[model samples]
Target: MTKATLQRRPLVKQILANADDNLLVIGGLGSSNWDITEAGDRPLNMPMWGGMGAPVGMGLGLALAQPSRRVLVITGDGDMLMSLGSLATVATQQPDNLAICVLDNEKFGETGNQATHTSPRNNGPTDSGAGTDLAMVARGCGIADTGTVREASQVAQLVKDLRAAKGPIFRLVKVMVEKLEFVMPPQDGAHLKDRFRQALLGHP
Candidate 1:
C-alpha cells in the first residue's frame, strides 16, 4: 500500500486521532511494516502464531468487552480467511463501532505470499489465494457497509467514516504489493514490545 502510493497516508493516523481508547490493530505477518505497526496510538499486531485469521475475533472480543469505545482491526486477507467463520459471529453479534480494515494484497506477505482467498492471480494450490470477493464476504458476514478502495489517499477518510460509524463496517483496500518489508533483528522481542507500547501512546 505504502509502496504503490509513494507515501504513508492516514491509515493508522486517522484511526488514532479519532481513537478514544477503543481501537486495537491485529496485523498479520505482512502487517509488520512500520507504517501500520508504529502508526496506531494503541497499535497491535498479532504475534506470528497460527490461526492467522483470528484477529477479527480478537477485535470482536474487544468491542464486546467495551461497547462504549470504537474498535478497529487492521488485518490482511490471508489472516482473515483462516477463520472466516468468525465473520458470521461478527455479523451475529453486530457490535456497533467495530470496523475491520482488510488490506487485501491478495497474497499473504507473512508466509512468502501464501495465496489468500482474495488473491487475484493464483498460480497453483499453494500459491492460489481464495480468489473470492472479500467485500462480498464482509457483506455476507453482516458488515454494516463495505467498499473496495484503490487509492491510498482514501485510507484516512475511510477510517474516519468508520470511526464515526454506529455499526460494523469494513474497508477492503486493494494494494498491489507490500511497499516495504520490515527487517527486525532475531531477538529484539523485549525491546520491540516496549516500542510497540510506546506507539500506542500516539493514538487519540
Candidate 2:
C-alpha cells in the first residue's frame, strides 16, 4: 500500500480495538481520507475545514481526563505548526497513553496547496519559508519518544511502537499531497452539530 493507503487503512480496526479509548480526530478536514470517513461515524472526531491546528490541545484534555485510556489524535503538518506550543504542554504533562499521529503532507493541501512551515525548501534557511521539521519540533518540545515515517509499510510498526511507548508519542508520517485540494463547503446548522454532539457523548 502507498502512504495515503497506509495512513487510512488500519484506523477502523485500531479504533474498534480501543473503543474505550478517547479519540480526538483534529486538523485538516480534507488531508486525511480515513479521518473523514471514519470521523463521520467516529464519536470523538473534531472536524475543521482548515483549522490546521488544535487537536493536540483537545487530545491533551481528553488524556488528562481519563489517563488510563488512550488518547489518539489524528492531526496534520499545518495543524501542528500552527499550534507547536501545545507540544510543550503535552511534554510537560507527559501523558503515557497519548499518541499524536501527524499526517505530514508538507504543504497545506486543504487550502489551495500553499506551503506551510513544515514544507522542505530548496532555498537557504534564511530564505526558507515554513521551515519546520515536525520530528525536530516534537523533540524540541521535550517529547523524547517522537519519530517520523516516510514509508507506507512502516505505519503499523510505527503505531505499535508509539502505543508501547511511555509517552506523549508523536508519529509524523510523511505523505505526498497528490490528492489535490478539496475545500469543504459550509453546511446548515443542527445537522453537523447534532451529529457531533451525539458522537461526543458516545450516544447512538
Candidate 3:
C-alpha cells in the first residue's frame, strides 16, 4: 500500500502547540531536534545535540522520575533502529507517562540522507532491502498501544495519544522526505540541562 504524504514541520507544530506546560519533550538528534526547535523552544524541551539513540532511554528515566508529568520522546527511524533493545526495556519498566513518536522519513537525515532499515527496497538509491515496520516491533516488544500514523487527519488523535494514552505508547509517523533549513535550540548541553531541570524541578 502506498503511504500518505505529510510534512514534518506542520505536524510537529500542531502537536507541540497543544502540549501543556507539564509535557516534557525530548527530541533526538538531527532533524528531530530541529523539528522541535521549529515548533518553538521551551525550557521543558530537551533537544539532544549529540545522543544518537539515547532519547527513548532518557525519556523513560524522566518519566519514571516524574510520575506526575508526561514525557514525550520524538526521534527518527535511524535513531530508534540503532537502539531497538531500548523498546523492550521501556516495556519492562512500563512507565505510564511515557510516549514515543518516531518521525520515520526512512532516511538518516543528518548523514547525507542514507536510507535506514525502514526505507522500502528499490524505492530509490538509498532504499533498504527490507522496510521495517517499527510499530510492529514495538508491539512485539510488549507495548500494546502502538500505531503508525500516515495521514494528516490522524494528527489530532496522535497528539492526544502522546499526552493522555495509557503508555508507554509508540507511534511511527511517516513524514515526507524534504530538505529543510535547520532550526536549532541552545547548543550547550549544560545550559539545556539546567533549563530543563529548573523548569521541572525549580532548581538549576
lDDT of 1 at 9: 30
Which tens-of-lDDT digit does each residue in 146-202 have in candidate 2?
887876567667757645666688888776666533434234224554665576656
Candidate lDDT (C-alpha), each: 0.64, 0.65, 0.92
Point out the worst 10-residue segment of candidate 1 by lDDT: 1-10
Candidate 1 stretches greater than 4 Å from native = 1-10, 14-20, 32-34, 40-51, 121-130, 183-204
Per-candidate TM-scores read 0.72, 0.74, 0.94
Best by lDDT: 3
Clashes of 3: 0
Model 3 error, position 105 (Å):
0.4
RMSD of each: 5.6, 4.5, 2.4
User: Would you list the clashing residue pairs of candidate 2?
Assistant: 52-79, 117-130
Q: How high a TM-score does candidate 3 get?
A: 0.94
Q: Report lDDT (Cα) of residue 136, candidate 2.
A: 88
TM-score of 2: 0.74
Over 107-173, each residue of candidate 3 has an lDDT whose tens digit, in order, gives 9998899889888787757665568899999999999899999987899999899878989999999
Error of 3 at 82 (Å): 0.7
Better of 1 and 3 by lDDT: 3
In terms of TM-score, which candidate is strongest? Answer: 3
Error of model 1, residue 158, in angstroms: 0.4
